[model samples]
Target: MLRVFRHYIPGITFVVIALDVSIVSATASLAGALGSWPGGGALWPKAACLVAVVLLCLYLADLYRLERHGRRELSARLLSALLSAAVITAAIGYAVPAFRFGRLAFGQTFLLLTVALGAWRSVWVTLDPGQRLRKRVLVLGVGPDAAQIVALRATGAQPYDVLGFLDDAPEAPERVPNGCELLGKSRDLLSLVDELRPDLVLVALADMRRSFP
Candidate 1:
């Protein structure tokens, strides 16, 4: 981990930051090419400004930190960061026309940035070959109570990341699950909590009969 301004961050994090910079810059260029940026000097300076401001907003939102986050949770944070960037960038451009890239251009760039970043993150979360990118979760039970969670996760609408299910009587057919992989019996609860330090342990068992571990 590298210490960035007293904040310890993994070296790989910088690569993501660099990618974000490129995305923002490209968005600005695309906007300018659309003839929306009028009377502009070279657009690079203006693009750089956008990149810096947006990056700062992302930093403030702690987006650079690698953590377990579901799509909805991650999207909320991204939306907040972009909103802050929009405000700060608009103010900077307004106070100094020299940095202004025109209203239409800025709007178009901002919109593009939003769409691009959102799409980028969707792929980022999905392409987790290591299965460690998303938030880690353990479902305590796989009964009727846990059905909603399973369904939500299946549709990728759940805010909290649910890795799998835990049942005392683990079945062979995915362990009485709705597309949720059965991790293990609840008896080994202590050992099962080893991976990625699960962010949440949800006890959603419909029936806690004698089989409860």
Candidate 2:
């Protein structure tokens, strides 16, 4: 779950705040249509306050925390936050008697809020900055450990600059399973990486002794 939250939670808060702004704006615009309660002239102020309340509630729920959660758990948390926001909004509107927000506006706000939040998440996934920052790297092995780094780069998880591989055993494949070059033997790593000046140097040699071997 930490993985999921670390990757998504801040951006989720950003999206939620955006959606809340839209919902509150919509509610304020249609306050009269919804049946304005007693102290109704200050619609915008009340709407702004409602938005603030939603944000506070989200924070209190720990919805904006950067803790990770499984996909199912994250979804449940999101759903609960949404429901809680709606309930709180309704309850406050009732108690204030001055904030006359209506049912049609409520429906519109909630529906639009969901769409806005989902869109923000989609945008975040599409525009992941790690993908944009292409860093070069050279792995020091052709074995299982090195292979995992290659897989991670290919999957767009870790931004790496894999210039190629440096295998000591000549008979060991000349190319990595993921197709980076077998630049040379393990002894040549420092020189190769120095020349490459890659953003990172991942020593994925299965045997730690082979790092300098």
Candidate 3:
């Protein structure tokens, strides 16, 4: 998770934002050059400003909060953000003519940014679930203690991927929720760690007094 402005954003979402900003800025510069806007050397600053405005619009529209909105909702939000950014850009251009790229360049840049950002986000959504960037967690017990972690997962409160439980008690019933894998005894910790490669191992043993190797 990436924290910005006290808000926790998913890592993938942050990557998307970075990509969008880069693409938007590039598109703006390209549009300016194609339209033959004056001050060719100084055009980059204008392009950067345009991208900043668009990103601010997107932030206001909650585009950065990936978990809160579904694809359809996100698309609608993006459209609204683009429209808002365009309006704000037009207003700024009207008030400060020196900062304005011509109408042709502005239109081209807006259209390109909309398409680029939308396509990028579409691909991100499609691939995000299969990405291994999310932390994988291994629970070290299968008793009531471990059940709490499973409960948290069931409630969707813990975002980490669970790699399931481990226990050494041969007679202990499966106390973890159904569908969660019980990946053998505690004695197999090293081998399991090697095979699973979990980002975190949570010790929730019922008998903490027992010496664990």
Candidate 4:
């Protein structure tokens, strides 16, 4: 359930915006019908602004979130938020004398917005599932730089397919043999490891390191 909610954030956001738009338009049209709205020309801009306000209000209230609340609790939160938004909308309509929107418009808009939002949430979840595979890789270097590459890969979500480490230095030899093979001389680098087909090739050598000798 937690995973499900995380995957549906985008859908929820889209729904919220759509709902706000529908509500504003309906409210403005109704106000116009009632002959209570401001000068005729200002209806659209005012409606647009009203939609913006509603969106802002939702944001402040944190209504359109996707946290993992239990089923019943989650439903309660949503219901409360919707009711709160409706009351706020009515208050705004009544207080601003210029904004004389109709109640019928508000009711219809709310229902339409509800249906649209729910449908969108369903569609978005179907399309985008979060889990994905990550390939593990082994770095074949024995220097400071090689260690850094290994570290960075570990932090990210994509799991690595690290086979092991391989040391190339000839003199000192490998100190901590981490199970990686010391595949032959560097000169045969291309031909020897062809089967590995690594997704990433990190050359972690200093200028002093000699070519395959």
Candidate 5:
């Protein structure tokens, strides 16, 4: 896990960053073409600059943070970042007339890039591979100890897909948290393992003296 802006992200940050940059660059190129820029030769430098500015703004806005945000809030932040990047790009163009894409071209590029980035982020959020790839965990008890595990799962920073708990004392009252299912008894471990195929099994036995097979 890597921490960014006080939020922890999985190891797939490199891949995600690369993909985002690629998409942004591609969008900038298309924007240039739409604006009738001289050619790829003249457009790439501008695209590179745009990519840097946009990415920097995103970083500053905590867009790279792993914490969940409502879709509306996220979209609003993304738009704000893009707008800030556009302002910076305009300032740079004003300072260096040679790099200017002209008012018309610059406007077109900003508009297109905004739409492109918005679409890319929407897809990224909707298809979060990290959530899909979270390790499936199975707890081996349903008592106070197991309840702690359930609470940890609900509040911990690390992402996990819990399959549920195994109740060793089948006849005892349910102690697991609400919404948490008692998958089965310890005797059914092998069959449950075959059925759920959990990535990790956590032993949370309430009784330390009890023998575990």
Candidate 6:
């Protein structure tokens, strides 16, 4: 997780966005390489513009916040975003001749973006599951409250994962009813956060402390 302006954004969010940009650029580059196209490396700027527009459309469609939405909603919204991108891209190509990917090549780029991006996201969903949407959580203590928290983290119902617990003692209890690993000590919160990078750090101890990490 990365803290930006006091807000915690999932680390995977940046990774996926980077991948999306790369995917978009690659598709654009491939289309730019078509025999009928003129410039060789001059395609980068146009590709960058396309990438920006596509990302903007996806963001506006709420694709980045997938945890709160379902698969069906995902597909529908994506289709809407892509269609919007295509229309905007076509308009830009018309108004700016220099950035225009010839009609044939533009069609190819659009097709590739749709298929490649759709396939990549599907793979992300299968491989990474809720990493994009769910928060990677690190609980501060292994107490009754933590155990109840573990209970409440229902499968497929919540948007958080209890990455495990941190305790004041070095050793964990014999039976951690929370069913999560004892990662480290409470004093090691900062170090553990740097190591695990959980999106949220929850203090689950029954006791209250004046200073908590």
Tens-place lDDT digits, model 6, residues 140-209:
8776676677777756575677877777643456535645667667787887787656789888775666
lDDT of 2 by residue, 116-160 (tens): 554554454455645335666767767776666777875675556
**What TM-score should be assigned to candidate 2?**
0.43
Task: Go through the candidates in order and give each one's C-alpha lDDT.
Answer: 0.73, 0.60, 0.73, 0.51, 0.69, 0.75
Candidate 5 has an lDDT of: 0.69
Say which prediction, candidate 3 or candidate 4, comes out ahead on TM-score: 3
List ranges where model 6 is wrong by over 4 Å.
36-41, 128-213
Q: Candidate 2: give the clashing pairs.
A: 1-68, 1-69, 2-68, 5-68, 135-161, 136-161, 137-161, 137-162
Candidate 4 local lDDT, 1-213, one digit each (tens): 011332312344576567656755665566557554244245665566557666765566555543323334434554565566677766766776454345554565455545554454444434432311345354555566654555555477674544344455664155324433444345544543464444554455543356322
Q: How many backbone clashes does candidate 4 have?
A: 9
Q: What is candidate 6's CA lDDT for residue 161?
A: 75
Which candidate order results from sorting by lDDT in descending order? 6, 3, 1, 5, 2, 4
**Clash counts for the predictions, in order:** 0, 8, 0, 9, 0, 0
Please report, as a residue range, the 10-residue window in candidate 6 with the lowest summed lDDT: 169-178
Every candidate's CA RMSD: 10.9, 12.5, 11.0, 15.4, 12.2, 7.1
Checking candidate 6 for backbone clashes, the offending pairs are none
Can you write out model 3's per-residue Cα lDDT over 1-213, one digit (the tens) per residue? 444663333466668678878998888778866755533336766776688889899989988755445678879999999999999988877777656777678888888888988887777667674332355788887667665676675356446767777787775555766767666678878877875567899888877778254
What ranges in model 3 sit over 4 Å off?
2-9, 36-41, 129-213
lDDT of 1 by residue, 1-213 (tens): 354553334467789898999999889889878888533576777888889999998888877654655678778889999989988888887887767778888789889988998888778878863344444568887776666776565356444566667776545334455555566677756665763256788886657676566
For model 1, what is the C-alpha lDDT against the true structure? Answer: 0.73
> Model 5: clashing residue pairs?
none
Name the regions of candidate 2 deviating beyond 4 angstroms. Answer: 1-40, 65-74, 129-213
Instruction: lDDT for model 6, please.
Output: 0.75
Clashing residue pairs in candidate 1 are none
Error of 4 at 133 (Å): 14
